[model samples]
Target: MKTGKRYSEAAKLIEKTKTYDLEEAVALVKKTASAKFDETIEAHFRLGVDGRHADQQVRGAVVLPHGTGKTVKVLVFAKGNKVDEALAAGADYAGGDELVPKIQNEGWLDFDVVVATPDMMGVVGRLGRVLGPKGLMPNPKAGTVTMDVTKAINDIKAGKIEYRLDKSNIIHVPIGKASFTEEQLTDNFQTLIDAVVKAKPAAAKGQYIKSLVVASTMGPGVKLNVTKY
Candidate 1:
């Protein structure tokens, strides 16, 4: 892979072997974000758990204190009054029978998040094969599947995010944009770290959080001292 000039310069600024404190890492990430566009800042976590074990799975949702800088496009699966409620609550697209077919036949997926009312799960279930892989499937645990379509849509629009472990036992989540104030980014980072820590499975042994790295979209990864969190 060929490296860009800006990325090479940014990488030079970070000590490859040094693990920084939470605040120091956050500051460095912000300082190194030299993209012309406001790049998104993300935190990647390597957890000590077997993702294959159902009980050891680390998955849940949290609302960032400062919210993700990007606007979320929400799609709601519902019918009747709930459909109107979803749209009124700012859902980008809301429907039921029509939606399932459009996605099933046309393969249309233009939304970021998917919210489905409980009653419509049966219909939504058919699209699991498509949405699941994209992490857009509405799950009860993530609060994306519920009776209150309005609240679900509003919460998603307000920066509620779901984090789940990947096959490699790593979780990558965006905390905020590079343009966010250091204080705002730190607050969001702490809120997510607290949620991940509290969600530790009893079956998880040894160090629950193995490693953590914070980085901007185009900047080099800044390793953080997990103990500092």
Candidate 2:
């Protein structure tokens, strides 16, 4: 594959076979960020579990200590006084059935996270076909589906992120932006890794975290040696 000159240069910084420690990996990721805009720093984990099996499914949420360095836009599905509660709690958009056609007809999905009250689930369920595929569906496990819209919105704004194994048994999530300090990124990284470790399914066997990689949005991946982690 033909790669850009900038990408090639960034790739050169990473040792193809060497696995770096968490600190070194984060530093390398930040150093290799060549984008003009603030690039997102992401952590990718290759897990051993098969996502196809219901018993081996690994998924959960964790709040980053330093936050993800991104302003999360939140949409709340609610009715009666709950709608007002959501907006007051820092929800970017809050409404009921009226917002349905706007999303279905206008293809309007301006928010990053979706939070719904227990009662508003019926109204929110109408958009399941559209939202489910996008990973925006509010699930109880991820703490997005709840009656406490305020806490949900606050947690989301505070950098709560969900991690789940994909078809390839890999989980990818952004830790923070390249513009953040190394210490800030490291804190978020540790928090996420700890959460992923604790969320291991009982049915999963063999190695849990097979491989770990950290990289900037436009940079090459730097492998992390988590054997000691």
Candidate 1 per-residue lDDT, tens place, 133-174, comes to 999989998999998887887788888889999999999999
Q: What is the TM-score of each candidate against the true structure?
A: 0.97, 0.97
Model 2 earns a TM-score of 0.97
**lDDT tens digits by residue: candidate 2, 160-200:** 99998888999999999999999999999999999999999
In candidate 2, which residue ranges exceed 4 Å CA deviation?
1-3
- Clashes (backbone N, CA, C under 3 Å), per candidate, total 0, 0
Determine which window of 10 residues in candidate 1 has minimal summed lDDT.
Answer: 1-10
